[model samples]
Target: MTQQIQQAIAKLEETMRSIGVLDFSGEVQLLEWSKSTSRDGPKIKFMMQDDDSVLPFEVATVKKGKMAGQIYHVFAIRVDDLPIKTNESEIIALEPAAKQPNRLAQAMHTDGYFRNSKLWTGMEIAEAYSQLDHKSYVEKLPCCGTKFAKHIACNGDVVGHHVKTSANSGIRIKPPHWYLVPLCHNHHMTWAHGSHAGSATHEDRHDLLLPHAVALTANQMKVKAKKIMGISSLSEITIELLDAFEEEIFGEAGNKYEDFK
Candidate 1:
């Protein structure tokens, strides 16, 4: 393995440990380098264990650039011991509306929600959601709660739903849909692959892009709510609710909570 490849493996191992995923070992498989792609760019390929049952993953190295030294990206599925099927049609049906870019920007700018707020970032949100008291948020959402409600339950206040593009190799650039699902502490950890307790590792820290995920989740919730209520136009309702949520969490737009940094 190249030095770059070894470094990637170390980072991946650290991430797995930080997340409490045990005995998860795999090897890096190199792929053909493309001239169209930067020569300095690390090659992309799968990581698999001896069992070969787990879904193989694509691991990319961070060349010196925008994502220098970082594990540029990883696309993998959680290996489930049980049987599971991927329904392309169902996934396709969940595609976010064409207004996604606008919605994403709106979400990013919504003060108390993410960018400017101190109270909630990816880490804080994940910590808060993992608590036992915060289970309802995950159970009530259209995708998560609606789908897996019976398996989990909690009474904590409902934070917004989350949605984002799947970065896993097989599904890259598929539909960038919104998942109108609720999330609590436990679920958040599961979502982050960091449920096991301890400080996050370099990889885990990189994966903790909670603010971005939260913003997207909230936006997805707005879309789902609009669809459910049969509202003619979602812009007004989404903005109104988002404003109210921000006020409730951050006190006021400019107040600027201390926990944000």
Candidate 2:
């Protein structure tokens, strides 16, 4: 295995430990490197194993340029291939959406709503803009921005980007709502997948970004609590409330946000 793949697996193991998916003794093993048929790029595959359990995953590696030799995407792969059971009659006699066009349209609309709910609304995202400006933040950083500096906007759609993309170890799950921070579209895209040619990518930089997201989200919650509860003073925003939010959003490892300024 290459040094980059080994390092990526080590970091993945650390994440598992933090989330209690694995104990300190648990280790991740690289299974193989295979070519992706569609993208024609090499994929590094690994699995987390302890005494009795093994969970497999694969990450796409950046193939060229400054970001080359870095793990780009890490995703879980279910090793078990349990056969799915289905009723043949029910499958063959499925109801057509054309029979209930209104219901189908309604379902589509509701799905859209659910999709949008994955991220905080633009208004909620704007709350953290004052305390933590993502534009200025990413502009000064090397991992997320450089060439796109000229195109970065001061006023545009700010998204509620999650610090932790997934809820569990390498599994694809949406993170809790409260783990989001206000980040501009440019920075968000840059970090996730480089937005422009020759732009920087995530490449182990989530460590630098996650803490900032946690801190800003906590502060934004405090401000929100002050406004909604009619608390006259920022000092009046109780620590208990922030603690509860952190525990709900950040799980067990959330940082102290009361003095995040």
Q: Find the candidate with the highest TM-score and give its number.
A: 2
Candidate 1 residue lDDT tens string, 56-106 = 111112233332332224444332233333753111112222433335223
Candidate 2 local accuracy as lDDT? Answer: 0.39
* Candidate 2 regions with alpha-carbon error over 4 angstroms: 1-157, 165-169, 195-205, 227-230, 234-261
Q: Which candidate number has the best lDDT?
A: 2
Off by over 4 Å in 1: 1-201, 208-234, 237-245, 248-250, 253-261
In order of appearance, the predictions have TM-scores of 0.22, 0.27
Clashes of 1: 15
| Clash counts for all predictions | 15, 0
The TM-score measured for candidate 1 stands at 0.22
lDDT of 2 by residue, 132-167 (tens): 443333232233222223344324455665556444
Q: Each candidate: RMSD to true structure?
A: 21.3, 18.6
Q: Residue 25 CA error for candidate 2 (Å)? A: 51
